[model samples]
Target: MDTSLLFWNNIISTCGVPRIITSDRDPKFTSELWTNLYDMLGTKIPFSMAYHPQKDGLSERMIQTMGISLGDHLNKNLLSIHPTAKDVHDMWKKACEKDAKCIAEAKEYNKQRWDKSHKEPDSKEGDQVLVSILNFNNLKGPKKMRDSFLGHFTIIKLIGKNEVEVRLTKDFSRKHPVFPVILIKPYFQTEEYRFPSSKKNPTAPEIVEVEDSPGPVKRIIKASKIRLNGKDQRQYLVRFKNQTADKDKLLAEDAIPDANLHLRRFRASRRTE
Candidate 1:
């Protein structure tokens, strides 16, 4: 699952990664080689990012398909699912392809929907959403983020597409609560919205409370940063305290006690004389 998803994400998201995505820092992304891979492409893999959100429908369908394909080969009790669980994956690919007619139909349906403003990403303030977090600690970045839902926060304001201002409270913050909108994933959460203490919210010029203002419909960005693990890191080359013609010369000199050796030779010559 990890290898396949990485395959899809890496292959599908190749446009210089300005719009980088992670299918949840699924253990596969954390592999040391992945850092070097994304770095070469010029984007930092999110250090404090959440896992890609899972869809129940997709998971259920995939599993059901797998079960049907493996049904005939099973020799276990009904409750145990693929006891080995370790599959060759080429087997999964073949199994998935067996439903050629159904797959073709699904593809055609998706093709018609492509570029047709499918569903808008997500909108409005105060909705609960899944935010992807990454394993920051390992990369000398944010703290260690385990694979889990970290918090349920509220969206306070929307900036241009790809960014938003959010508060991690029913009570909004005065300054630092504002974060970039990319980290938020809109779910069907409506209960978290809290009206500020001020009653004349609309009349206030401060714009502390976000209102559903109509405008040139723009994309929403999250107030908080998406956490991810890898950095577009580069190694620093070693330099000397004083400029030298040859670094290797200093290195070789350190290897043997040249002064001591020379002094011993001179003393032996003096004794012989």
Candidate 2:
């Protein structure tokens, strides 16, 4: 290689000489000639950092990242060979074998994802689920599907096995009663297990992780527990407020008295965080 042009051209290509150059002290890197060239260019030479055993863990992780990237590249190139994948086992044994790393295998994997052939899961009565808004970009629907759940939305009616009637969230309307299963998703948490909040209190709710529904915007989250129903909302459900009281019943009603309960914002509704 013509050392002068090679060195000067690289310097020019980089816009200008950097104040410092950090390099790994490889044979080409640490050569006295390389050091002298940098000195002539008026750039401070910072030697390649020494590798530490603990820091080498990062290097190992980087190598793994590179391997995955290269694997993705090879799989993308392998697309043209997709049709021949199954035949790899019998025809082109070198190319067509089904493997986690094989192009043919990648095509098969992608096919399963895009294929409409698989049966859809049934949403039936008495099943728990999370709800998703099919299109909240609808001027008026529960705004956003309640909590991704909206819960144990018991199927009150069956549209089909894959489609069934579920209970409407209080946020929607009490009179609305039932909603279709298309609004719901399987209520599942990815976490392996949950922890009890207080070991001493067996009756206390377990401390568990639950996913948040995407709100109109990011929510300001807070760490707190809230009860869904109060005495008044319970009364609204039971219809005590709508009862016709007789003279005798009036006395009992006076004794009991009516207490109004407020239900406004939802529990952990919006989060600052």
Query: Pick by TM-score: which candidate is best?
Result: 2
Q: Write the per-residue lDDT of candidate 1 for residues 19-121, one digit (tens) a residue.
A: 6343445566677556656655556665323333353345445656789989976656643765544555677887788888788999998887884755445
Poorly placed runs, candidate 2 (over 4 Å): 1-113, 116-118, 135-149, 174-182, 188-273
Q: What count of clashes does model 2 give?
A: 9
| TM-score of predicted structure 1 | 0.21
Collision count of model 1: 31
Worst 10 residues of 1 by lDDT: 215-224
- What TM-score does each of the candidates earn? 0.21, 0.23
- Worst 10-residue stretch by lDDT in candidate 2? 245-254
- Put down candidate 2 lDDT per residue, 1-273, tens digits, no spaces: 357457668765677756554445678877766777767766666553445324345555665689999887567547476866546557655443444357767788888987767556676657666555443232345654444444445566766555565676665544344444456666654333233453353477779996442222111112223344552212111123333322112111112223112111213233322
Model 2 TM-score? Answer: 0.23
Cand. 1 Cα-lDDT:
0.49
